[model samples]
Target: MTPKAARRTVRIAMNGVTGRMGYRQHLVRSLLALREEGGLDLGDGTVLWPEPVLVGRREPALRAIAERHGLAHWSTDLDAVLADDTVEIYFDAQVTSARQESLAKAIAAGKHVYTEKPTSTGLSGALELARLARDAGIKHGVVQDKLFLPGLLKLKRLVDGGFFGRILSVRGEFGYWVFEGDWQSAQRPSWNYRAEDGGGIVVDMFPHWEYVLHELFGRVTSVQALATTHVPQRWDEGGKPYDATADDAAYGIFQLEGGAVAQINSSWAVRVHRDELVEFQVDGTEGSAVAGLRTCRAQHRAATPKPVWNPDLPATESFREQWQEVPDNTAFDNGFKAQWELFLRHVALDTPYRWDLLAGARGVQLAELGLRSSAEGRRIEVPEIAL
Candidate 1:
């Protein structure tokens, strides 16, 4: 008879459950889902269980979330939770401005930390947090969930297989029209458009671009960007008008290591014309591929179609139909949940996990450089961070 696996319950103090990404992705989809599955099998003699202690500023909201999820633990005080020795891990999904202080507290409490990115509002603060986590000798990580998406996973597979030999360039388009609150209620929080609240497309998205480019291709060597606040006036949640001081749109050109150029446009003012909300097109010597959040398609050099550029005639080529869909060889789980399991294992078993706070600082660094480039109206070289 086979022996039963040992079960270990890990209490994680989760902050910012009131937020959209925190509630939906981290709590419901990831942690709670893991609990429902009877915890994660650690591929050894043990099974790792996740017990969440919901933390936030509002008691009512925290209590409501805890009750809805059949959880007994919820706290309005972060310090109270941090003081508990049983809470081995502290996860932060708070607003960008509030993140650094809370993370510092968690580190001070000797709790392992995992957090959402652009880890801090600025690069210096982010690096400080990273340094603190490193000195504390605690397991730490930042959310880089997009890398685990089905499309990016397939793209990684293609890269690993040398399908796109000598990768030349990458173009990325991301964003959608965020409704103004007056006529139609805003889709995002009002704070997202307020500069005082640490809001901007460059700050929000350049972090994502930084990790994606660095991990898949090479490190970003330089940046040229234009950040703009297209929608100047916007109504808040209370139907009150306010100045939108943050950049709603950002256009950037990044030079990657190995001479690859990447151009990405991120905007909240754009209408969708592509198949997905976000898409990246990569062109190489041997082939080219386009990938979105869930799908990836590739066209080999042999299958490339050529069309004569004649202004007088309408084009006859079905350019969209020419690409072949990349098959999902294996089933994909939710990206947030996947990373959660990995972090849990890293905590329980000391597994190899590389996406730490330092990696997160790199994201913040790119965001800062991108914004600086826009402000200075010139290309800015990315400096390597050491700590």
Candidate 2:
């Protein structure tokens, strides 16, 4: 709203803004915050304003979110919103099942597409959407927020600096116990436990792992996985017991394009005992580094202490103390907001973007392969997705 010199406004049809990820990360933290800062500077003195039009099914929730953010536009009718020529982009944050249908409609309606990951549960559906978007010749993107995370950024810096020398392996531990809704309200929605609603740990986390692994190291070539429903029964939001048909936990071993190996364990049934809810420890020839959500620590090979195999006896040395903490030399912005700005710039200034619909399809392919590996009880080779 600042009096800027000839700023252009990009009207974004933000579908599924009633959901948690959509509202908290996209609407509030990213879009509204950008608006509050007087929009984005395009580096040539002209600013790019992002005007988000909230679209959802529930009238009350949609009205509430829009009013709280002081947004002027919102509607329950998606078709009507898409019909408006002013709407340039359609962003989807809904369930995985709805991604293909919603995106196909948006692409057909001549609107650019942007969305959260796991574009579809099946590889075929995801590929179809990607091809559709490509055929439409409109701009598209998927949220790959982890790549812009501070801890991951620090790790990337170490890699770029050749601190790792030759990378060997990556071990990722991600999980936290979700409280059952019987005595305590569940943090996640009840539908997340149902397979019918396109909910599962492998589908959810594999998308993140795909981008993380691809961005940090290389492309994932194969996967060997075991997925299970740790907590089969849990109370729903309405205080009624429901069968948790979806897998709440997944253990995976991945083979990257390089000789390096990667293992990731994702679960919602386990308690947190490590440095953070999600942490990745990468080992290399020269050193090893462990990165959490906001921090990273590294230990050089020369500094590694020799430990005697005396597990039966009391420990003597502090293993964790050997690594030095990496300092925050620069302010880390919100990952989602940063990506949003980039996407805006991509739309406005025709900047290069890598996280397109094809990238999202790759995520879907990984999740599908992981599930297949679990079901078939074997390692599945990940083939390159071609249009």
Candidate 3:
């Protein structure tokens, strides 16, 4: 071994390795990449070196993941991994219902943590986890994958460059039809359909939208929403019909701190007719931009879109064709894998890692407020999160 390569090692213990997110994010994206490529190199021979010492899961699945990732250590005992001196960081991608318990245990064992979004199913649990992490003096972070998307990054640049002057309102359309778990076998896990498992569109996706909204426009102040369950029943892993008790779709309007307005729609059962599944439209005094999943278009006041009631007008010249594709400018990779690299650098090199627990709590806060608004049939003011 090279003298410099043996100097530092950041041991990691990953919890919940059997599930979908666990397999994709932890095993394939994070741990495997770290082991094979030696972690992401920050610069000047400095590298974020990760030593995945323990991966926790059920017995059979744990063994499979160990063999898959070529990991030497595996366990089903959370406490054992936490107690190991070789493990310095604890990562969790468990279901939202179990996130709080796993995180609390990890913190008590005195290890830094990084976990998936919606830190918890509700505001209270999320707040408690944030407090524990702070009191324990351990660095904590949550996955905000949307912030790293190539399309969103380009949009951020436009906003920063004053392309959208004094933004007036923002609109977002996010969703795609998931399987009914019978004929198609359910694209998402069965746990997502169970309210008890913290599975709901609002909780799963609002956290992602929160960061994007805050990043593009500003902080959200008030939210009014309506939530629904389009699919009442879905098949479980065992291929039996189970009644879905969670909201599968949600429509909401948010008032930003700066008086900017945003309308967001999230769904798991909807057919999309757009270029990409997700799209965002931002309007400003000087200009407006329509950002589809893969494309973005800017319109100045001189070129502002016009509307007509007359059916004679020739199909409103396909504006989609007029827009140019925004190029990805950031050097960092995209998606969850990219976030993994950034988090590793943040831990090892003290790089600017602002995606912390408080940001995550903000997401949970929004979800809680949305649910309340829907249930009360009125607009709800979002409470300020105390990080």
RMSD of each: 0.7, 1.7, 2.3
For each candidate in turn, the TM-score is 0.99, 0.98, 0.93
Worst 10 residues of 2 by lDDT: 1-10
Give model 1's TM-score versus the native structure. Answer: 0.99
What is each predicted model's overall lDDT from 0 to 1?
0.95, 0.92, 0.82
Cα RMSD (Å) between model 1 and the true structure? 0.7
Off by over 4 Å in 3: 1-7, 292-294, 305-307, 330-332
Error of 2 at 76 (Å): 0.4
Candidate 2 error regions (>4 Å): 1-4
The order of the candidates by TM-score, greatest first, is 1, 2, 3
Top candidate when judged by lDDT against the true structure: 1
Predicted candidate 3 versus true structure: per-residue lDDT over 1-387, tens digit per residue: 743634367888887768887778666776676657866666756666677755555788888777776777888888888888778889988888888888899889988899998898778888899899999988889988777766677788789999888999999999999988777777889888888888999888888878888877899899999999998998987789999999999999999988899999999999987767888988999888878645676777776667666886667677666655666555655377778777877777777877888889999999888988999999999867885
Per-residue CA lDDT of model 1 for 221-314, tens digit only, reads: 9999999999999999999999999999999999999999999999999999999999999999999999999999999999998878999989
Q: How many backbone clashes does candidate 2 have?
A: 0
For residues 193-276, could you state the per-residue lDDT of candidate 2 as single tens digits? Answer: 899999899989999999999988999999999999999999998999999999999999999988789999999999999988
TM-score of 3: 0.93
Superposed by TM-score, candidate 2 places the C-alpha of residue 247 at a distance from the truth, in angstroms, of: 0.4
